[model samples]
Target: MAILSALRLTRAPGAAFVVMGLYWGVFAAHVPVFRDRLGVDDALFGTLLLGSSLGLLSTMWLAPKFDQGLGRAALPTAAALLALAWIAPSLAVAPMAFALGMVGVGMASGLLDVVMNARVSQIEARSGRSLMNANHGLFSLAYGLAALASGVTREAGLPMIAVFGGVGLLALGLMPLLSRAPAPAVAPEEGGAVRLPLWPVMLCGIVVMIAFLSEATVESWSALHIERTLGGGAAQGALGPALLGVTMTLGRFGGQGLAERLSETAVIRVAALVSATGAAIAATAPGPMVAYLGFAVTGLGISVIGPMGLALAGRMVAPHQRSQAIARVAVIAFCAFLIAPVLMGGLSEAFGLRAAFGAVAVLLLMILPPVLALRRRAAAPLAVPA
Candidate 1:
């Protein structure tokens, strides 16, 4: 009954995840149109995209203050910002306009990411159920569907304005649902405000970094690997990301069930090994079909590691500190996003994509020791204020 209730309660945060995915999906599919409209070259457009990352980093640093001030209101506020920002690119007439718009979108996305995850942690603590995997799964599913829909609309000659407008409207419609959901009550520190421990938090951050690095490698490079390395055409290359996305969605859903039946550490250990093996297979595959299979296996293996790491971090501190802890870990983990493209690009330029991916496989295996450390510490009591 408790689990059922928790499942029902996930609707609010899950909806936020879906909206986020929808915006990103539409943005990715319409990038060419946006670049053409702004009259920018590939290098210039790439530089503009960096504006989003800057905005993300700035807002993420400020998210804890928003949480402290707004409490339950913070979630919807960020969602509203995202909705408003979603339409910026559609309305841009020049390069500067588009860059400025991306900054807004990035800021809003960063805030939403932290707040929504923190909300899920609060719910999990209160309901005594695992919700992260299900919530994240919903995100991946929405992203896949939205990307497909955007592609179809583009093929049918729809404008970027209409596509982004529709996505913004969908986000607006979800705001009320998110805003009305009450924030879970956190237990007050018995003595005073309790500081979160450092080492465990750093460990969690490291685990998440590795997870994102592996995921980014598969997502960003799989298509190139398929087309260039495996001698496949565009359609076949497209299947690489599609296969990873589908398997990731399925794996996350499965992870939700697995969390109920096994310890978090056990799940992480198994997931790491599976991901490593998949990466190895993908790196060495001679054909697109076999590479697709490898990507699918890798997707399944990595799908749950981020959510599990976040859950473990949340559990390590007092409820009131969950947001801050999550933010700290998130900030560090997100650096992987900034670092990965450059790292993979450099490696691919020098050693080729297959070799780059092979290095990624080795990095995936490095997650196992951290999982073991978490398991060893699971039996120890957290030093909460009393």
Candidate 2:
């Protein structure tokens, strides 16, 4: 019963998923609309989008710091700020205004990303079980639903800004729930000093980095891959990402239970290998339908890595040190969010998008050694008190 209470308390971050979903689903679908409305060419639109990505990147480092100062209250407030800021750009007032708004959105949403997850970690500690994957899957679901709704809202001639404003208001309404969420068990940056036998934590971060790279590529380019590589229609192209989202969401849902049933090491190993296979198949598939299957496989394979990595970090360290340790891992992972797009984009530019993807596919094999190290550590006997 106490554990249930704690889950209820820590669960406020789930609302963040809704806000993120609303924001991501809407923006991703409406980028072309915004570009046309603003008279910006593809290059300019790309730059603006990159700005938002940059804002998100900025928050990756500050996640631990933000939580240190504000704790549980940070998410809703930041989320509200993010939603409110959309008012300027969604309305299409001016180019400079939209730029400003995107920057603020980026920063707020990015910070909230880390803070909310950190908060969940606190909850997991109190609840004495794993819940991160489910929480994130909920996030994925929210994004998918919101994006689905965005399409409906768009067709109804509703301004994207209005849609965003309404979503933000909903977020505001939910802020109290987020605020009331129980305080997490540890500070956001609690685990800073524990040393491991391998992977430099930073290197482990890099190992996982490629996985993120592939995800970003799919997020940014799946539609294009569908349209160009598979000769699919625009509608089909659009659904490519949706398919990816659905697969990832489902994967994470199953992943949560799987992580519990098996060692995270075994789960991640299989997951990576599966994801690699998916990426490779998608990269080489000759048609749209086949490509999407590959993407789905990739999504399923990659879904568990994030939550598993986080949970492993928590178990590896002393309780007081966990938040910091996980925070460090998050920083590295989020950094991948920043780098993956550019790297994949570059690869896509230098040699077809397929080539870019194939490169990412090849790295999936390397995820094993570090996971094995974590398993060994987990299997070690606890020390007896002196």
What's the TM-score of every candidate structure? 0.81, 0.81
Q: Pairing residues by index, what is the TM-score of model 2? A: 0.81
Q: What is the lDDT of residue 208 in candidate 1?
A: 89
Q: What is the lDDT of candidate 1?
A: 0.77
Mark the 10 consecutive residues where model 2 has the least summed lDDT: 184-193
- Top TM-score model: 2
Candidate 1 worst ten-residue window by lDDT: 180-189
- lDDT by residue (tens digit), candidate 2, 1-386: 53234335556887787677667766655554665677754344445556566777787777667766776677777787777767766876556666777777778888778777767766766667666776777776676566556656666778776778778778878888778655534524443345543344554565456566666667666766676667875456556666667777888878766866898778888988999999899899998888979888988888778777776765666665565566677667766656665566567666876887787788676777777776776787633222
lDDT (CA) per prediction: 0.77, 0.69
lDDT of model number 2: 0.69
Clashing pairs in 1: none
Per-residue lDDT of 1-386 in model 1, one digit per residue for the tens?
A: 53345547888887788888777756655555665688765446556666677788788778767766787888888888888887776789888888798888889999898788778867776777777777788777776666557656766788878887888788878888888655735545676555777877888898989998888667656766776788975446556665666777888888877877988788888999999999999999989888988888998999988888887887778777876687788888887766665667668767887888898899989998877887777768877755
What is residue 370's positional error in candidate 2, in angstroms? Answer: 4.0
Question: Which parts of model 1 have CA positions greater than 4 angstroms off?
Answer: 1-5, 28-49, 68-73, 88-101, 154-161, 183-195, 220-239, 285-287, 315-325, 379-386
